[model samples]
Target: MSSSKKARTHPQYELLYWPGKMPGRGEFIRLVFEAAGVSYRDVSNEEENGMKIILDMISPESTGDSDSNPPVFAPPALRIPGEGKDGKALLIYQTPSILSYLGDRLGLAGEDEAEKAWVLSHALTALDLNNEAHDTHHPIAVAEFYEDQKEESLKKAKNFREVRIPKFLGFFERVLKGNEKQGEGKYLVGSKLSFADTTVWHVLNGLQFAFPKELGSRKKEFPTLFETFYQSVQEQSRLKEYLASDRRFPFSQGIYRYYPELDRQ
Candidate 1:
């Protein structure tokens, strides 16, 4: 990916996650960088043996690295050069934490302390929905194959489409309505776009892919959310280009998966 003029001054941010087409949690961090028009190295996607790099980063046998940075617990970690002790690379994990850290530097956190807090809060809530969506397809166990728990997945997906989806979508709809004075029904926090908006938008986009029929039927019920907020976030100049570009991978067997049997009949 080409770097913008503004991105040239910043450190080369490296994203370490599972390789290939799945957006996964790394997409959250990607959105922040894309929205800010900043450049970052999607290490696992761009470099050879990049998946091995992620495996080594999260290896159980390793306690810490030579750079004195603590071991990451999982994928989607961010490595920033010259940000650690003695100018070593700073390594951080956890999707929410990584997004928050980048949010501030990228100017997507919010304008002030209160907006920042709300931004994080809203982002966390959206991630909760993302996790719930994942559970629908693997309700019995994460390590086990979905086919082994197909029966359970059916029940889980049903409850998710009928209950959990509306719960989360309604909550966000109300948030946008409440913030309409400042956000004009397009943002979840303050006036401008924040990481929270992108975070929530991505989750909603995943929901559409995972449960097309369900989301299609429910869109009218949450006009502000599905119509205004969702449409606005995608139309953002940089995000619009990124969404259409090859960089934005299609939704597949990642956090969001499509199963016709799991979707609405």
Candidate 2:
């Protein structure tokens, strides 16, 4: 389907996030829209004065919008026009919540109740890894600069590479192995693609970029996850096109960051 057709079919979904090249948590939402081939407005990236729009939405004094929705705590909020009460736009935040809602709408949740449960379970697990990765760089305090916490970061990153990485990757490899009868090591829950697969793929991609040496050395241990699942998720038609296009941003100072000292020796 073409862009125009997608625009007409799906709601004019607006994604509000920090306006920059960093993927952050917003990238998870972007991956979903891309994989589903849906049209959405990346408010911070595409709109003029997008930064102000985000600030205003998350402002401390703000209570709630005219849409009757609650106040947003942060960015990566989704606004769906006419979805709220009295035909007003609905605003929602939180990455996992947004993914869950969109997953159901985009047919990426799962085929049944059981599969849906597993999809969310696996996605949440992947997000846990994402959070751990962020902490590796900001071990002491999130507000402090990485340079100030370099000593602690080194310790955090070392343990992350040696212990946490293998633990998370091993879990996913087992998931793929258990579902291989249906998923063929490609899908996490059912036969088709789900948000869970996309979620895990992004984390692994970030890890590979953030700690290339650490991941490269361990790839052979998790063949199903690295060799099959990771490669297959990115090659999905719509995701592949989006990744190759300018819409996708490379990891930098966001949740994933490459620090030479923090990686394997």
Q: Which candidate wins on lDDT? A: 1
Distance from true position, residue 217, model 1, in Å?
Answer: 0.4
lDDT of 1 by residue, 1-265 (tens): 4444553778899988899968999999999999988899898788899878889999999999999999899888999999989999999999999999999998999999999999999999999999999999989899999999999999999999999999999999999999999999999998999999999999999999999999999999999998899999999999999999999999989889999999999
Candidate 2 lDDT, tens digit per residue, 131-184? 999999999899889999999999999999999999999999999999999999
| TM-score of each candidate structure, all chains considered together | 0.97, 0.97
Global lDDT of each candidate: 0.93, 0.92
Candidate 1, which segments miss by more than 4 Å at Cα? 2-7
Off by over 4 Å in 2: 1-7
